[model samples]
Target: MLNRKFGYVFLLALLASSAAVGAEYKGPLDVPAKVNTKFAQSNRLTAVAKAGNALVAVGPRGHILVSENSGQSWEQVPVPVSSDLVAVRFVNATHGWAVGHDGVVLHTADAGKSWVKQLDGKQAAAVAEKSFKKAVAEGSEQAKKSQDLVTRFVEEGADKPFLDVLFLNEKEGFVVGAFNNAFRTQDGGKTWEPLFWQIDNPQSYHLYALATHAGELYAAGERGLLLHWDRQRQYFSAITSPYQGSFFGLLDTGKELIAYGLRGNVYATADGAKTWRKIDTPAPDSVVGGALLGAHYALVTVGGRILLNKSDGSGFDVIPASSPMQYASVAAASDHSLVAAGARGVRVETIRDQAIQEK
Candidate 1:
């Protein structure tokens, strides 16, 4: 569940571990990722999505799980890489893409039943290096720094991770990740253009979430990094954020735009980014998962508590899970149910009959 919330913490941990390596390992990029026979469905999953009537979840070890009967039973789907998958998006019932560590991007034509690797860190770094070098040669100051960044990417091998992905349809899509790594594909997964230079991310902050609000695309990430699609320029422009902390998830409840992140910080804007007001939570724990439950917004914290807010932003409540499982991502499976994935695997929660217990 590498939504905006979990991607930052997970990527930081991954970077910390990879930093211990003395040098980059440029091994075979085409090698198939390993598949564990057992515990595939029970493994820690980062994100979940609804594909028609089916539920798809992805996580560490390139694991992808699908459950046609909601979250009750899941079957593992074979993947081509060993990278940790963080985020997944399904445009319709069948077409979708999954992104993960090592800058890995995978595509599925038949929903989550089968997949093919579209791109990975090996090719991503190469593409970036070439593009940045070209920019440097043209005397672009930004390119000079971009070259250094991509050079480090090459040195780090496939350690980088793509935190989030979004597809406009079966063909047009985008994948975003740490250090301003973003790519766009107009011809399905056949080709991708490096978008690192297009956005207003001068600091190269990690782009954690890619979403659509009011029929417009938006991205949010580290240090209050917020961006909205500029259709005319074919780029994402920076949006003014009310909070300076990292935002982990973006939710559009039709009536309002919500950006939530570290330390239970939730801000809402009904007039796009022109105005924002804080929707205070009960605790300081990070909000790792969220969904639009009917007329309210339900946000799940990493501390295993679910926070609920009214559409008018007038009421708030907290409901603790029965177990202490650290939830990562959640999706509205139905009008009354939510499917969440995280440290304890995937679970279906019934919210209709649950009483609102304010904290």
Candidate 2:
């Protein structure tokens, strides 16, 4: 089993070695009649979303590639700039947002037929300046020690660095990140208001994943932390988990919910996220993200491999794929069709028409 804990040497070996060009895989895959060979080497697969019959993959430096008719043929949609897009979410075909490093955020209202930059990296410039001014004000022995603190804020975004985003609808959504960065939007992402709590020497913790189910929101990240805000608490409660890995992706299977993390950490809950059960899998490939298709099924990116893990109402099987995913993430169509994608711009398809137990 590939369950690489952060401190486990075996997990480290798996993470470092799994992405090598020659990882062997004997899983199900689609051999395109005419594949887009150029995308096979891309390290830009950050997130995947199902759009119509098309599977849209987003990645670093403004790379957006789409495949219609279930990944048989793909064409690049001309992106406006070369910004490193870390994650994307489509509410429908259009009206979605992608967030990434820096304060970069992009929006597409036309089903990614086109996109426009909504936020820029400039917002973070204030973080560096504020640290500098504070350090200068304490120019003594304390100020000398403050130098390290200031550098931390300047370099590591201890002041403000956002991680994941969740839009409940086009009108209402939320974003959380480092330095206690939290914001809520009520006007379809048109505007946002900060949700901050003052602290002495605030630090940074990147919000790794955000999910919504049954009128509640959940966000989890580093230190085996899980936070849920619902009708009562409306604030995050620190929930403990069995593992210490960062939970990166979540799926609301309606019947049951699945939350996964680095390496092969999966926690499943039948009555929502109330109680979770652990499941074994192959390789701890840091499944950074996922997409739920239909019910009881999803497409997930593990380590750097894509697996169409299936749920027959109660349990899930990591239905194999044909090859090692060049990238680390994948998405499904609205119909649960698997589209594995990754770096070097690689993409492979597995439609519902394909059997899960394929030899």
Candidate 3:
């Protein structure tokens, strides 16, 4: 009987190990129909912003897809290099920056008419080191991790070192990433400075989201590592997060801030970071990212769930978007017209027209 018990235990252990390996292959299982296509097999979507009457979405392997007349139609912009793009912010209808892999930063002055490579992180660090005010590797955890990302994976069909960027305007912005990498630029794309010298455990921290709310910069990363900017010193400091999973992105609802993370991890704070509480999500899969639609509505976007939204009193309702969004991401205009970005370098525009009145 004892031997029988031991055998059962051994089998269970093996099964558990297998499950962990499978979990890392996390994917959008029930992707909406619209984003599923051969050309748009994008993995990590980093940048989605509105430009003029167009919506631009940028992502891995130098993928830039522009949607003219909202997100109803898309066209690919052939980038000069095969770099992974992670984030896009438009200061106005014309000026913007898209940041991504290999320390790459792209800028467009003539709208989407042209793009120029502004600065690479590796190159920026070298330049910063020559300056008298070069900030020494802060010896913080972030600095240590930044060094570990010197080499990146280029596995075919796999997502590589992902990043996130935010711009208060075309000239001043910051881009952050996995391996504790962070860069700041004040003169648009003229030059950049490393926020921290290195990040500890270099490759351990996978940053997924960044946003500025109420004059404070907030960053969220793997295992729920949250950081806030200290304006006086111009650096980031660690803060307590409610979960241990990676935060894909954040939703600023004005009255509340929702810090959404892996596997349905969504935490809300009413009085800023003084306190946080988890909100229940209807979906069971890990949420990769999301954004606000309007004053009383939000989209619970993940890589797989094309469009999930929470109406004022109706709770969570899937968006009526026709396209099946796979490996999806979501953003919203101030007017609440929803724009989703993701793999295949794709973007979709949607709006809540009306709901059917049931008998």
Candidate 3 RMSD to the correct structure = 12.0
Whole-model alpha-carbon lDDT for candidate 1: 0.82
Q: What TM-score does prediction 3 earn? A: 0.73
lDDT of each: 0.82, 0.59, 0.62
Off by over 4 Å in 2: 1-43, 124-162, 178-180, 196-203, 231-234, 299-304, 308-316, 334-336, 351-359
lDDT digits (tens) for residues 34-130 of candidate 1? 6653487676889998888888999887888888886778888888776788999899999889999888999998979999999998888788777
Tens-place lDDT digits, model 3, residues 166-269 = 78876788877655666677888687766644322233577677877666778888878877777776667677778877787776677676787677667877
Per-residue C-alpha lDDT of model 2 across residues 1-359, encoded as one tens digit per residue:
34555459876687778867346632111111122325522554666676655567666656676766666666667665555556777777667777665555667777666666655434343443453465467563433544554454446532243567788878877776654455567887655554432111223345667787666677777756676765463456555566677777677766555678877677776654667788766645666666665443554554455545554433345655566554556676545456665654555555444544431
Predicted structure with the largest lDDT when compared to the true one: 1
Best by TM-score: 1
Number of clashing residue pairs in every model? 4, 25, 28
lDDT of 3: 0.62
Number of colliding residue pairs in model 3: 28
After aligning candidate 1 to the native by TM-score, how far in Å is the CA of 94 from where it should be?
0.8
Candidate 1 C-alpha error for residue 168, in Å = 1.5
